[model samples]
Target chain A: MRRMAAIIGCGAVQVGKYPDRLESELALDAVRMALLDAGIEKGQAEGIFTTPDLRGGIGLQANLLCEYLRITPKSMAEMTCGAVAAGLTVKTAVNEIMLGQIDVAVCYGAERECSIEWFKHFGSALFEPVALQPYASYGIIWAYAMSARRYMHETGAKEEHFAMAAVRNRRNARHSPVAAFKAPIAIEDVLESRNLCSPIKLLDSSASLDGAAAVVVASAEFARRVCPKPVYIMGWGQYHDNSCIIPTDRCDKSISSFVATREAAAAAFRVAGINPEDVDVAEVYAPFSPHELIIPEDIGWFEKGEMVKAIETGETEIGGKIPVNTDGGLLSRGHPWAVTPFYQTINVVRQLRGEAGENQVPDARIGLVHCEGGMMNNVFVLILGSE
Target chain B: MSKVDFAWPASRHTPSGREFWAGLKKRKLLANKCQLCGEMFFPPRLCCPACLGDRLEWFELSGKGTLYSWTEVFFAGPEFKTPFLLGLVDLAEGVGRIASRIAGAEAGELKIGMPVRFTFVDAGEDFTIYCVTPDTG
Candidate 1:
C-alpha cells in the first residue's frame, strides 16, 4: 500500500464578488487563517507553494508568503495552473511530503481577477487580431460553442436543457455563503441574457471574479499529531495535449482534452483502486455550460449523449445520485483563472469531512476534484478520501 | 425593396488576408504548404512549428472544397451588419478554411459537408475579400 500524505487542515476564504485591489494582502489574510486553522507555527512549515493570478506582481508571491507568515521553507515555488493551480500545488506538496522532502507545506492562491485587465498577449502575429483580440479571443469560445452546438444538434437537446445546468448551480450557490453569484437565476433569465458566443449566453458561463483560498497539506505523521481529522490524498494525475491542430482533426484527439481527461481519470482511479461510483462527490471544472456535460462523460461518469438526461433529471446536483460541484462550481462560484481549483478542493475536503453545512452529502467518503485549463488543453484530476 | 450598399464590400486584411487576396486576383486560392511535412494550412503560417522547419512554400489551392461545419451567428459585432452564416470549409488540398456568408442560404438553412466553391469580390482600393459560395454539382 502507498503511504498516504494527509491533508491536515484546509482553510478557504471568499472575500466577496468585488474585493480590494491588494493581492498580497488578501493572500496574507488567507494564509493567516490557514495557519491558524492548522494550529501550527509558521516556523514549522517546511515547504511552500503559491498559485497567484496576474497580480501579486511577478516572482514575489512566495517571498510575500515567506515574509507575511515568516515561514522560510528550504523549498518554495509558485505555480500558475489557472483555476486548478492551488489544488495541483497541494497535490505536489503532498507528493513532496511522501518523498520525505518536506514535512509541512502550504498551498495558496490569491487574486483580484474580476476587474483586472483580463486580456494577455505574448509573441508573434501570424494570425494578427485573431490571435490577440482583447476579449478572451483564443478560439476557446468557438471550440466550446462548437462542441455544445454539436451535442445539442445530435441529442435533440433544447436550450433549456443546457440552461438547467446553470440554474441548478446558481440555486446551489444560493446556499453557499462565499459564492460570487448567490442570487437565484432561472432558465428564462439565462436564455434572455446577452449572448457572448452563440448558444452560450453570459448567464450560462462562469464569472470572472476576485477571491483567495489556501490549504495546508502535511505528512501523515504530522497530520495525525496536529490536526483534528485529516483527509488523505488517494490519487493524482495530469496530462498535456497539442497547442496547434493536427493533420487529421478528430475531436477526441485533436482537442487533446478528451484523451487527457480519460488518461488522468484512469490513472487516478488506479491509484485509488476504485471506480467512478466509489466517489461520493466530484468537482469537475466546467467553465462553460456544455463542458459541464462533456467532462463527466470523458471522465467515465456516463457515455456520450447521456449527460443531458442525467443532468436534467437532477442526478448531478446536490443530494442527487452523485453530488458534483455542491459548492456551485465555476459556473456560479466564479472562475478567477488560477484560484478556482483551490475552491474546488475546499469543497471536496469539506464534503469528505462532513463539514459542508447546507450542501453536505451523507456518509461521503471518496471525493474527486478536477481542473481543466485552456478548455481541456491540460487536465488535472485528484481523488481524496477519509481514512 | 430596400437599397443596400454592395459596390464596396467592407473587407478586413491581415498578412494572411493580403496574401489570400493577391492569390485570388490571379484566380488562385492560396495555402501555405509546410515545406518539411508537406501539410497545407489555409490561414497561412510563417513557419511549420510542427516540423520545426522555417521553410514554407506558397501553393495555389484547388478552390473546390466542402463545408466541414457551419453556424448561423444570430448576434454579430459592429462590422457585421447582418447575422450571416460562417463555416469552416475544408479545401480539397486538406485544410479547414474559415469564411463568412454562405451565398445562397438563409439563416439556419446551411448543412455540414456541402460542396462549395471559392469566390472573391472587390473591396475598393485594389483590395478583395474571399469567401465560399455553394458549388453546383
Candidate 2:
C-alpha cells in the first residue's frame, strides 16, 4: 500500500513589487511563515524542494535556500519547469514522503522579476535557438496571443469573453488582501486597454511582480501526530507535451484544447475517484484571459465551446456552480512565474480549511488546482479534499 | 536605477541544424524525415521525436503552407519591429507548423487557412531568416 501525503500548512508574502528584497529574502520570509502555519519547527523539514530562480539566474538555488533557512535537509532538488514548477515541487515532496524518504518536506518558490533587469528578454530563453527565434520574436505573450486568436476563431468567443474573464478576476481580487490589482474593472476597461497583441489587450495579461509562496507536505503519520487539520492530497497528476514553440505540432486539431491538461486532469480524477461535478472550487493557472476561458473546458469542467456560456451566465464566479480563481488567480494576484502556482495550491488549501476569510466558497469540500508551464507544454493537476 | 548590460552570443547548432541554416542562406527550407516512421519534422532534428530513430534524411520543404494561426504583436524584442504580424504556418508537406513573420500584407487582412509561401530575408552578417507572405497570386 502506498503511503498518503497531506498539506499541513501554507504561506505567502504579499504579491507586488518588492524591489528592495532579494529573491532569497522573499523565499525565506514565506518559508518562515509556512513553518509557523504548520506549527512545525524549521528543523522538522527533512526534505527541501525549491524552484530555480530563472529570472535571477542564480545558481545552486536549492542549496542557497536551505542554507538561509538553516534547514539541514536529507534530500533537496531545484525544479525549473516554469509556472508549473511549484506544483511539481509539491508533487516531488509528496513522493519523497510517501516513499519513506522523509517525514516532512517544505516546497517553496520565489521570484523578483519586477526587480530583474532582463525581465523582458527572459521570455525567449526557452525557444529553439536558430529556427523559432528567426521567424518570430518568440515570447510568452506572443505565443498565448496566437492561441487566443485561434480559440476565438474556433469557439465564436469574441474579445468580450476574454474581457469578462479579466473583469471577473479583478472583482475577486477586491476581497483578497494579498492580490496586486484589487480595484474592480469593467469589460470596457479591459477592451480599451492598450493592445499588447491583437485580441489580447494589455488588461488581458497578468502583471509580473515580485513574490514568494511556500507549502509544507507531511506524511500521514506525521500529520496525525501533530497537525490538527490537514488537507489530504487525494490525487495528483502531471503531463508534458515537450513542444517548445506555440501552435504545437498538434495544432491542426488540438490548438484550443490542451492535451496535456486533459491527460493530467484525467489521471488526477481517476486517482481521486471523483468526477468533475464533485469539485467545489478550482484555482486554475491562466496568465492570460483567454486561457481562463479555455482551461476549464480542457480540464473537463465544461464541454466543448461551452465555457463562454458558463462565464456569461455567471456560473464561474464566487457562489456560482464552480467558483474559479476565488483568490484572484494570476490575472489579478500578479504572476511571479515559477512562484505563482504555489499561490494557487495555497488558495485551494485555504478553501478546504474554511480559512479563506472573504473569498471563501460556501461548504467547499473538494478543491482542484491546475497549473501550466512553458507555452502549455507541461501541466500539473492536484485534487485536495477535506477528509 | 543603474542599467544592466548583457549580451547573448550567437547560438551553436548541431550537425543537422547547421545544414538547415545553410539551406536557408540559399533560400531553401529544410526538414528532417524519419526513415523508420516516415514522420517529418521542422526546425530539423537529428533524431526522430516520435520513433526515436537516428536514421533521418534531409528533405527540402515546398515553401508553401496554410496559416494555422496568427497574431499582431504590438510589443516584442529589440531586434523585431513593433506592430508586426507573426504567424504559425502549417507546411503543405505535412512536416509541421513553423513560426514565421508574415510580410507583404496587413495584419487585419490575414485569415486562418489562407495559403502562404515562404521567403528568405538577409539579416546582415550572413544571417538569413525565413518569412511568409500570402500567396495572392
Candidate 3:
C-alpha cells in the first residue's frame, strides 16, 4: 500500500485505576515505551502531539509532555477536538510526516478518569451556559439513551438485540491484557444490569480507568529503516456536526444513525480506495451498545438494523468477515477518556501486524479505526493497511 | 464563576442568560429570537447561531411541544438524583427543540411526538428549573 504516513510503534499502559499516579507520569511512561517499540531514542521524535488533559485540567498538555520528556521538537501541537482528540493528534502527526515537515512524530494521551466525575457539567457546558440548569442535560449518556429509543423505533431492534453487542465485545476482551473487564458477560447479565439510562445498562458503558497510550508515526522513508512491519497510514477522513449530543435537528438529522460517521466513513474509504468488504478488522469507538450497532451500519459494512444478526451469527467476532473491536471495544476494554483512541489505534495496528495473539484476525491486511467525540458529533475515520 | 460571583443559581451559569433567568423566575418560558433572521432557539445564546446576528430578543414561548425522545437516567453527577427522566422536545412553534426533565406522566406512558407542555418549578432554593409534561388538555 502507498504510504500517507506510517505507524512505527504504539504502546499503551494497562488501562485501569491508578489513583496515585499523576497523568503526566503515565504519559511519559507510554511515550518511552512507544519509543522503545519503534527502536528509536527520544531524540528521534521530531514532533510531539497530545490532547488536553481532562483529568489534570491542564491546557497545552503536549507542551508539558515535551517538558517532561526533555526533548524539543520542531513541531508540537495539542489537538483538543473532544473525544476524538487523541486520534486526531495522531492524524496530525501523520499529516505532518506526510507533509515532510518532520521525519518522526510521537502523539499520545494520558487520562486518569477513574474519578473526578467525568461527564455531567462537561456535557451541560457543551450546550452553552444556559443549558446548565434549564436543559438538565447532565452527562452524555442521556443523549445516547434517548437516541436508543428512536433507533429502536426506526429499526425494529429490541433492547435485547442491542445488549448482544455488549456481550460480544466483552467476550473478546478475555485475551486482551490491556482491557479492564476481561470477564465475559452474558446477555442476561447485560439485560439485568443497573440502568444508567433506559436500554443502556451498566455493562454497556465503558469502565472509567486511569491510563495512557502513545503512538509513534514516522515518515515512510524513516519507518522502512527502523521498523520492519509498519502499519501504513493508508487514508483518513474527518467530519462533524454542530449537534453535539442532543441535536436541535432532532431525529431528522441527529439520532437514527450518525450522519457524520456515515459521511466520514465514505470519505475515508474513498481515500483508502477500498470498500467496506476489504476491511478485515476494525476498532470502532463505541462507548455505548447502540453506538456499537450504529457504527458498523454507518461504516457501510452492514445494513441498518442488521448489526444484531451480525453479532448473533458470529459474523462480527474475530476471524469473521469484518471483525470489530477484536480487543474488546470501549464497552469492556475500558476507556481512559482521551487515551482510548491510542489504545484503539494500537489494537488495529497490531491486528494488521499479526501481533494480536488470541484476538488476531487472520490475515488482516486492511483495517479501519474509527473515533468519535461529543456524542458522535465530531467523527474521524481512518483506514489503515499493512504491506 | 460562582453564584456569589454572578448571582446566578447554577454552579456553572451562563452570563448571557440574565433575561432568560429572570423570565424563568417570573414563570415565563423564553427563547432567543434572532432579531435579523427571526429564528427562535431554546437555551438562549448571546449571538444567534442561525444568522450570527448579535441583535436578539427574548421571545416568550407557549411551552407546548411534542416529545421527540427521552431516557431514564440512573447514574450521573452527585447533583442528579438517580432514575430521573429527561426528555427531548420539539417546540410547537416549530422554532427549535429543548432537552429537560420530563414530568406529569410515567416513563412507560411517554411516547415520541406526544403533546407536551413545559412547567417551571423553583428548586434548590436558588433559581427556577423547568420540566416537560404530557399535555393531556
Candidate 4:
C-alpha cells in the first residue's frame, strides 16, 4: 500500500497591515512557528513548496525563501494557481510523502500586499485571461459580480441578502484572535459601502493585508510518532476549468452557481467516503460575500437559494448546522492571497484538535476547506480529518 | 456620440486576436468558427481553447445580442475612468458570449435580457473598440 501523509503542524503570522515587514520575513515567521510545532528542525524537512504571488510576481521566490529560511531541501517549487495554490502546495507535499520521496515537507505563503503600493494592482491583474486582457480591464469582483447578478436574477435575492454574508463573517471574526475586522457590522453597512462592482460593495470584499501562513506535512508514521494531534490528509479534489468567457450553460458552469465547486466538493466527499452531513465544519476562501452564499449551495450544504434562508435562520453561524468559516473566513480575516488556504487549513486543524477556542465546533471530527483561483475558474477542495 | 470620451491607453492586439480588432475598423463583429466542431469563438482566437479542434475561420456576428449580465465598474485602477458599464452580450446567433462596453445606458435602466447592437467607439488614442448599445428595435 502507498504510504499516507498527514498534516503534522501548521502556523500563521497574524494577518494585518505590516508596512515594514518583508514578505519573506512574514513567511519565515510562519515557517519557524510550524517547524517548532511539528517538533521538526529546519534541517529535517526534505522539501519546500510555496504558492506564487502573481500580483507582484516575487523574483526567485522559492529559491530566495529557501536561502533565507536556511534550509537544505532535495526538492522545491513555487506553485502558481492564484489563491488556490495555497492548498495545492500542501497536496504536493502530501504526494512527496506518499511516494516516500520525502519524510517531511513544508508549504507556506507570504506576501506584503498591504505594506506595498502594488496592493491597488492586486486582484485586477491576476484575473483576465490573456485572451480577454485586450477587451477590458476587469478584476476579480467584476468577474464574480457577473455571477452575483445572475444569482440575484434567478433567486430574486436582493442586495440585503448578499450583505448578510459579510455581517455574519464579521460577527464570527470577533471570536478569532487572528481576524482583522472584528467590529460588528449590520447589513446596512455593506449596503451603504461604495460599490466596487454593482452587486459587490467595498464592505463585502476581503481586506488587503500583509501576512504569511505555513503548514508542515509528514508521513503517517512520522506524524504518529511525534505529533500529538496530527490531522490526516483525508482527501482532496481540484477542478480547473480556466474558461475566460462568461459561462453559457444555465445548468452547468453558469453565472449563478459554480459547477466547478460542485464537482470538486463531490470528488472530495467521494474520496473521503463522507457525505456533506458528515462534514462537521467548513472554512471556505470566498473573497466576496456573494461567493459565500453561492459556495454553500454549490457544495450541497443547502439547496439552491437556501443560503439566504440559512442566514436568516442562523444555519451558517457558529453553533449553527454547518458552522462555516469559524475563523471568519477571507471576508473578515485578512486574506493574503496564496496564504489564505494555509490559514483555512490551520483553522480546520484547530477545530479538529478541539483548540479553536470560541469558534470551535463541539466534538468536531471532520473539516472541509474550499479555495478558488482566478475568477473561480480553478478550485481546490480539501478534506482533513482527525482520528 | 460622435466623439466617444472614454479612453483606453492604446489598442493592444494578440496575434490570434488580430482579426477581431481589425474587424473593429470595418465596423464588423468578427468571431472564429471552428471547422471541426462548428462551434463559434468570440474575442476571436486562433484555436479553440474550449474544444481542441484548431482549424478555424473568421465569422462575422450580427452585432445583435441580448444582455447576459453586466456591472457598472466604479473602481478600475489608474489608466481607466470610474463607473463604466460593461456587459456580457450573448450573440443572437446563439454561439457565445463576449464582454464589452455597453454604451449609452444608465445603471438603473438595464435588464438582463435586453437586446443590444454592436457599435464602434473611438477611444480617442487613435484606438477604436467594438461596443454594444441598447437596441430600441
Q: Is candidate 2 or candidate 3 better by DockQ?
A: 3
How much DockQ does model 1 earn? 0.19
> What digit string (tens of lDDT, one per residue) describes model 3 on residues A204-257?
788777879999999888989898998998888889977766676333565868
lDDT of each: 0.70, 0.82, 0.81, 0.80
Q: What share of the true interface contacts does each candidate keep?
A: 0.05, 0.50, 0.56, 0.39
- Model 1 per-residue lDDT tens digits across residues A1-387: 133687766666663554545777777777777788889987888888888546436777789778876667977888875455776687779878878899999888877854334422221122342321111122344446655666676666677877988888888887775688888888999999987556778887776777777888888888888877788888887875643322122222323126777878888888889998888999988878777777887888888778889888888888787778887888888877687787888888888888888888899999999886655757799998887
TM-score of chain A of each: 0.91, 0.95, 0.95, 0.92
Arranged by lDDT with the best first, the candidates are 2, 3, 4, 1
lDDT of 4 at A384: 88
The numbered model that scores best in lDDT is: 2
* Models sorted by DockQ, best on top: 4, 3, 2, 1
Per-residue lDDT tens digits for candidate 3, residues B9-121, read 55456766677777877988887888899877766777888788999888898989988888888877666557778888888887667777887678889888899998877
Model 4, range B1-137, lDDT digits (tens) per residue?
45565454434455666666667768887777889888766556667756877899997878999888899888775756778888877888876677777778898999998999988866566656777899998
User: How do the residues A139-211 of candidate 4 rate in per-residue lDDT, one tens digit apiece?
Assistant: 5567678888988988888888888888889988898867888889999999999989888999889877877
* lDDT assessment of candidate 4: 0.80
Query: Docking quality tier of candidate 2?
Result: acceptable
